[model samples]
Target chain A: MNDNNSMAYAQSDTAQNESAQSSPVQNNSIYAQSSPVQDSPSYTNMPLLQLNDLCKRYPGMGSYMSVFHMNLIIPRGRIIGLLGPNGCGKTTLIKMINGLLTPTSGSVLINGMAPCPATKKVISYLPERTYLDNGMKVSQMVSYFADFYEDFSTEKAYGMLGALGISSDARLKTLSKGTKEKVQLILVMSRQADLFILDEPIAGVDPAARDYILRTIITNYNPGSTILLSTHLISDIENILDDVIFMKNGSLMLYTSVDSIRSQMGKSVDTYFREVYAC
Target chain B: MLGKLLKYEWRGLRFPFLVMMIVLASTTVLTCSVIYTINPNYNEAIPWYSSMALMFSIFLYYFGLIGCSIGLSLIIVIRFYNTCYTDQGYLTHTLPVTTRQILHAKLIAAFVADVLMVLAIAISLFLIIQVTLHHILSFIPEFTYADLMWEISRGIGEFEEIFGIRIGLYFAYLAIYSLIGTIANIVTLFGCVSLGQLYAKHRIIGAILAYFIVQFILQVLAYFASLPMYARMLGTSYNSDFSFFGLMSPTMNLMLFFSVALAVFMYFANMHMLTKRLNLE
Candidate 1:
């Protein structure tokens, strides 16, 4: 696996239940270990996500790329950590995945389709910023999620809200910042999506809340769904991640399994990230 | 999905609309009261202070109505910008909907709200006139509300004699034009905001500039299109035969076509920017 740099991360620590054989990597798609092969026959031959020469350049920024020609394939059911320094295009890449931003050069194919309405159904995204309407109550936000996302579980959302001691009747504007973050996190984590793309979920959150969030993400997500979380607090989330993607200057630097990193490099992802991205 | 989007859009809009309605209703009542109770006619010989207060009330009432109408438009523009372009756009864009769906929902919602506002203001004005006239006409022995309405209906016929069209038909045409115009206006505002977002560094300023430029261009086009017709009408007006509807009909038809074309152009422009050129910061 280590020798095959392009397909190094196809092995999974938790998705070993599948008996499917390894398929050849197609169109330079980011290959990951197969899981839930029989869950959907149409996507059985397809990777969960395929990025082909994806490039994005923002306007008014000359000779600079927000996301350079990045190619990656993320498989289903592994929690992958998207690690990068500030302004390293982690968010930009994630936005392209979720269709919040358009790519300049290539394509992002999800579940054998482009990033259209169907793709959005399978990708549950929690942006770094709080996107909840402040005028709405926590309960109304639940209704909103239930209305838009067919896979969203209102009962699960309300249960999590109660477990976190968040009042459903409380308006979002009245909640503390940390509490609002928790609400947004709960809204995202409550969905039963095929892919959960969380951008900086634990950033700006307290240590206790971070622990709770990481725990919730690990325990609550469907074992059939993949999780791609982006954050700078690598050490805090390093243990839960099955794979790690290191981005530098809007390009993919290294993408491999955490186990491979440990066996070959003899270092934690956090330490390796520091040495690679040190200023 | 467009229905769901419209539902949420109206949820965000209702509070502002409510406030506007309250202001409109109170000012309508106050203006009506001042008209009858204080008698601020120049020759009535009322107290100077009372007359000043009456004039102030009148000014506020008129401006208040105008402000509410214009304020509704601003609210629609700001709502479209905030939900579709700001940090909030992260959720909106990620929804399992197309860019056209979102734009269409906003257009329909804004058009409905605009029509409601116009209707409310029109009803308030009608009430003030009707109620005040009813009170004033009570002292006259033979003049009743019915009689006034009959006279008004006949006066509408005289209006036809001059304008060469029935008052009802005129109002029907006006209503149709206003409704379509409202939709075009909303689409243009949203299109401007979408166009502005492409600027990346200066979205608000870019949007404002885009609005001014669009307005100026539309004005220039309209002037050129209407100049010949107006010259022809003026040439007719000087000959003691008013070409009121003739002047209106041709230009109105031309503007109606222009308005639809502009809306379609802006809609496609917005769709292109949203789907292909999304630059959310």
Candidate 2:
């Protein structure tokens, strides 16, 4: 809540030192490295999130895996888009990163630590659904977040709520669906976490609300933090994305930058995504 | 973090809890009013209208009391399922707290709510009984609150002499047993829900089945556990060296021990499922 605490949360010392030592754009080269297992010597510079041989298979499903043998690293300070079709394991991957679901095999590490309370403290997550208690008023929700998340800025949250013309006294059940989504986004973006994972942030909102939601996400997130936005609506958020990770059939198909996808592929990311994932 | 979790948990549950309290209080007041209104002179038959009104009031009072008592626990259980393992779990499980911490907060909140409900019911019952006794004793000339207290104390003394255990200690044991029993039931329900969620389909049905299976197992254990007590009771009669401690202590201690063990096991089992085995649909 204070400037010192906010600064501490906004950027970890290692991240600050890494940023000062080399530009994040330069560190993007690390993605070219082969998938490293846990405690690999190649993992000198810790990515914000790293998944190694990650697989999730439901029981009695006869070997049909949801997310299979996925190995990837998500760096900090970049807005990465996790693009995939429905049931492509995008949400499952996100849930694994957020510790919502455990992987049937392998590991997901946040800041060199597995998804635990320590990692959870630095990872702010917005689920795809309206997960708030309907009985709670907007102000009560704000208080709840503040009480639980030390990095949560009540002032910024209220300011965003005000800009959206959402009354703090209004109960969640009384709010429209779009309004509730906006509130969820506001609550998520209000945190000064090192990693922000937003799942389908703008899926069902109107164009204007979608624009507003994207703007809120862009403006409110801490600079040194990473944002992983998952949505099928790639073009709408393509401009804001620095990197893109294409997932298909529970495996990582591509992990590259938008610029590379554009310059090398000679097409927009969305167009490229359509071509890659075309059935 | 546990405290914060508890604060929100309490906030979420406070509405139903307050409503239950209000219902109990209102029921107690209605009961007292009915008792006060009913004529002591029943030697002469009461009017039909008055009798009908009295019957309705009494029925309504008891209905409200029973309904709130039953509803309070049901609401608590449903709220637990809804908040911890339902869609709302996305918000809850994402908070920067350990699964154990979250479970602790829920368990503590539910335990406190159960305790409060029990206390409210106890107080309401005592008030109703006290008011009814007061009204009934109005027929006698020299009845007072002090006399009432004296009578209670004398009854308790007589009970202690007969049972060969101190009244306060007996009540304390009962309270401890009740608390442990409530916690055991709650944790077992949570364990069932957690286990049920492991199924890929028909989770609620799975939960119900889990409940029945767990209840059956517990009943079997209880039967085995009470064997010694049953044997002791059967072998001895009240006329021949009946020891209250010997006759009752083994069963009570075994039950207390079992309940405590089950509560711990269920707590850990619930935490394990929430942390390692959680799959939120």
Candidate 3:
């Protein structure tokens, strides 16, 4: 709540310099042509996202930091996994990144600027819960997205609905829970944003749906955009991730490449997560 | 963006409002028809059940007319709470619009909706009164609407002579007072809903408690604001020279100032909560 001194908006140069030191992906070969993680450190190549000394706390929780002083630097075109245990501030981090919650301290710079409406235009977010009104139809939601986001593709949204056999004309309440999740995912994936923050996107769906959802996410996102996904089901999304971030107690424990985790420890990301977050 | 937000907000509300208006209009017509059928020439008492049914219908009609205004306020408050502080808030807050735009849109929509409800109520009341008075006055031979008009105007003219002010000006003051008061009440409700987010759990209960606390504070402020007016009236009463107008302007000004101040305060408080302390589950 101390926004006056708690947060600062650094120029895009500040993010460029910090990103050069801590690019999420150490190697760019994973998605050879897609990610420009190896771009030169300059204003033109400013990181897609940055967090500097970010902190968030609930006043009623007696100084409990939901997201403590954590810093992150994400370059464009990489899919990063944000893995954390329960109450480890994964959603809190995502909420701040999407400007749903103001940071108690520090800064969240998207494309080197603060999280404003301008930044929001480039970030497509799928929250952990269903955010659509059940009274509306799937088609109405598609229309709403198209109305708000210039980059939204109504044609792609309807095509995905058709593929899933979900009638866009049906009211959301008339659909099953899994179908609603798919509808949300389709709407989010249809956007041509610079960053896609998907929080537990696959948690509510069947395993079959999870694979399709992940695939849809991988294929639908424009190459220039970065997908910062947070989920506990690390195995489901491990393969698609170019980089991985582990958080604990509201702090960043590690930020490195999926290749590094597999090569250095000879363990899959899921197995490593099991060991790191074991209670 | 503000326009877009308002457009969707109205679209979301249009169905419920339409249903309410249809119900209200149907009730008004039924009440007038029932009144129209009452026998103005009957000298003997009617059956107890029949009389009771007629009285009950009229009572229900007036009750509904009053409820429409209150219902609109409740509807807006609940909508504000649900869309801004519930699961739906995830989409609301993430929209590519500033918090100020969102709050202003909500406030404007609520204000406009309530104004429409008040207008509906006013029209319904006028219709009901005209119908009921028609039945009552039918018994009087050669009594006309012009006669009723003159009666009311004469009373207003006498009051104006004593008050030394135009009756029209007095009504204007009352209208402005009401409009400002409505804005203030709606903003306070929004502020209470925002305050509910302070609770880590049980936000609805927090909102209910905040509403009671706010109402109590407003009541206390209102009482204090009226003290000077009461003193002026009380002093004039002892001299036997009291004019109601002596109380009108000062009371109107005091209440108007308090309402404007309250509205401005709560507007800022709600915006601050949305921007800095929003809690969504």
Highest lDDT scorer:
1
How are the candidates ranked when ordered by TM-score, highest leading?
Answer: 1, 3, 2
- lDDT by residue (tens digit), candidate 3, A1-279: 112112321221232223322433213223222222344233254677878888888777776677767766788778889998888789999999988888999999998899889999999999999999999999899989999999999999999999989998899999989888999999999999999999999997899999889989988977777899999999889999988877766766566678777876788999978866665
Cα lDDT tens digits for candidate 1, B159-264: 8777767788888999999998888888888888888986778999999999998899788878777876787687785674654665677777777778778888
* DockQ for every prediction shown: 0.71, 0.62, 0.69
| Residue lDDT tens for model 2, A1-279 | 122222322232332123222322223343443322222333347878878768887678676677766777776677889998898789999999999998899899999998888888898899998999999999999999898889999999999999889999999999999999999999999999999999999999999999999998889767678899999999999999988876666666556778777775688988987866666
Q: Which pairs clash in the backbone of model 1?
A: A10-A33, A30-A72, A30-A73
Q: Which stretches of candidate 3 lie over 4 Å from their true place?
A: A1-45, B240-242
Clashing pairs in 3: none
Local accuracy of candidate 1 as per-residue lDDT tens digits, A59-142: 767756766666677778788899878887899998989998888888889987889999999999999998888889999999
Would you give me the overall lDDT of model 3?
Answer: 0.80
In the range B1-281, model 3's lDDT, one tens digit per residue, is 89999988887777777767876897898888877666666686666665676787788787776677677777888889888998999999888999999888888888888788878878888988998887778877688777988998899879777885778987787788777888888898999888877775888889888889877877887888788788887887677465677766676677678777877888888988898888777
Q: Work out how many backbone clashes candidate 2 has.
A: 0
How does model 3 do on interface RMSD, in angstroms?
Answer: 0.8
Better of 1 and 2 by lDDT: 1
Task: Give the lDDT of residue B233 in candidate 3.
Answer: 78
Ranking by DockQ: 1, 3, 2
Please state the interface RMSD for every predicted structure, separated by commas.
0.8, 0.9, 0.8
